[model samples]
Target: MNVRFEKLYEETKAAVMRYVSAHCYSITDIDDLFQDTYLAVYKSMQSLTEPIQSSEAYVIGVAKKVLARHYSAVRRLRAQIDVSLDRRSGRGLAEETADSVDVEKLAGDRELLDEIFELVTVMPVTVQRAFYMHYVLEMSFAEVGNELDLSEAAVRQRVARALTEIRRLYKRREQL
Candidate 1:
């Protein structure tokens, strides 16, 4: 209801919607992400220390957080389902060979992966997709770039920047 918020929304909503839509996998997710993005932006606006320099960037940042949260939840749910299915199917030779795995190490790795996923969502939309397609989806830079309408060099740059940012965030967390 704030006048400033209305102005910010009017200025940035399309950009925010585009950012969310680009990252989402399905039409249903697009609507959910778009609405959640605004909700996050509204909540974040209340905690601002000063007037934002770029409303579009601020809204995009909030959208990134919202998207991160959504992905984390989905990953957790998927993992849970996998575990349950594995239990139902019983242990195969490969699964049985995992008995030597250290629970603590697995836990630590999961935590690190979650942190990396969080950092990925902090990047710009293009960079995020570039990183996801190139790494997670195992697409080559040229393929990813072609799909995204970017040059191969541009895709490489975005993926590199995304990794650098993730490493920076990881190091920052380590120091904390």
Candidate 2:
């Protein structure tokens, strides 16, 4: 590894481990996320044009993407499991199931939370990083701005835009 990447790893490895551990339920999952996060950083490190103001924040951003992709794949796998179980039981419970047994009930409002995450994922990378740092990780806007090389006001705007998009997505999904 180059000196810069080595320095980044040494500086941010603990924070990355903590991030993965906090976000995942299992040790295996944490390991997987950690590996994936480092891989992402390694691949993208070359493309970073400017000096990194906050290596911790940048690595955390990569970790968040790894987690999101992991969760999305897990959700798909769970849906497949549900389908397989229903088929194996050889009983059609679809019609008799209560209307309340949708994604909301299964996840206790987590469906909406996942929707917000999905919306955030589609945002520009910088904006997504700012929003995640400020909201999900509870970093101050000033901290996020410093990390992302943006003004605090710019971070605030990114967060506001992300929120607006999430609200719009929620409303549109509700209508459907």
The prediction achieving the highest TM-score against the true structure is 1
Model 1 agreement with the true structure over 20-118: per-residue lDDT tens digits: 655764323556887888887788788887989988988888888888887797664763422223322321222222233344544566666776665
TM-score of 1: 0.44
Give the lDDT of residue 51 in candidate 2.
87
Q: Give candidate 1's whole-model lDDT.
A: 0.65
lDDT of 2 at 137: 68
Considering summed lDDT, which 10 consecutive residues are worst modelled in model 2?
81-90
Question: In candidate 1, which residue ranges exceed 4 Å CA deviation?
Answer: 73-147, 150-176
Error of 1 at 65 (Å): 1.3
lDDT, model 1, position 133: 61
Q: Rate residue 19 of model 1 by lDDT.
A: 67
Give model 1's clash tally: 0
